[model samples]
Target: MNAIELLCKARKAKKEARSEIPLHHALEVRMQERGWKIVYYGDEAGNRKLASVGLSDFSKDIKSFAFRSNTSKVIAIDSRMPAKNRRHALAHEIGHIDLKHDLAHLTSGDEKDAERFARLICTDGTIFKRIAIYLFCILCLGFGIYGSVCIAATDDPNIQQIDVSASPAVNADEVVHFTASGEKYHRPYCSAIKGRSSFATSIEDAEKNGLEPCQMCHPDIN
Candidate 1:
């Protein structure tokens, strides 16, 4: 999916911090939410040597930037920026993080997404938009396909030859499979049902069909 789609569907960054809220408090809350840290160019008013830290260019004027340091994400906002610009910068960096853009390889598309996200937060936002964002998230996460691991069929006594191609648009790795005659559905590679005459369906569907999960596989399709 695209960046915007991911933002709308997946759990990215929290964008509901109101404009009226204190930007510093918002920043602190946001940073804490993601286990992130914020810092200035200088510590105790001294320049932090950030040549290899993030995407900042000391030579050019920068509003704000985000980068990974060790095991944490850090957002660096220029101390010189005014209140308005600082808020934008905070949203911008938070945008980069929510988009999951690669700091090592910044791209035009990434910048555009960050800009869009920042503009969205910096301005007076609507509750409907925020609700819409998570509404899509619920639909996607609740019903979308999630197949990250491959399942292989094995020779088993209870089952015969397997044919995943019999089903359309179903990957053998992704969905739970079970025979209509059986009382239980199973992971595709489940020994009890592998190499058997079976129909593929999601775990949710299997349960809806009143099929219990197989004891051998302990199906966890998500």
Candidate 2:
């Protein structure tokens, strides 16, 4: 199987997020729906940090990574990572676990698949296309037979119901002011809060920076 094939399989499994939803919640919901648990704790067999990897040894280059088993473990994303990166890392690791190639002990090819999976789930088509194209080139030139093998074995029957909301298109320097309509509050998830004065384009951005969603608005939930 090639990257396209892997992606086609993933798509067939209904794994794509909604076209425009915020990447963070879209990904988290998808992960749970697909049976990959998410947690903030650090004791899982895999951990997140400067980089994400599969512990199943799917790729030799990785010092560590997550693997697929009936073990019922959390994705173990690094709680301390920047919010944007933490979202991608967790999704990438979930790709590895979902692909189930770790049992074969193949590395690079699986890593590529995982990356591709991450791209598909966590990004827009423009970005996903770039990563997929790169993987196709590497698949043909780099791993040869092993690459083909890894691709062939990648399949799962899970899909995500993503919201498909566009990431806010705003200049970073734009002064985004909020009005506290009755002491507005936004709660995105188990952590973080938001207020009328929050200047972020999105609640997730605020939470990533260690701020919570407005308790009244609950931007994270929407």
Top-TM-score candidate index: 1
Model 1 per-residue lDDT tens digits across residues 79-128:
77787887788878877777678976889978876776666555433433
lDDT of 2 by residue, 54-83 (tens): 343333343234545675544655555678
lDDT of 1: 0.56
List candidate 1 stretches off by more than 4 Å.
1-20, 42-61, 127-222
Q: Determine which window of 10 residues in candidate 1 has minimal summed lDDT.
A: 159-168
TM-score of 1: 0.46
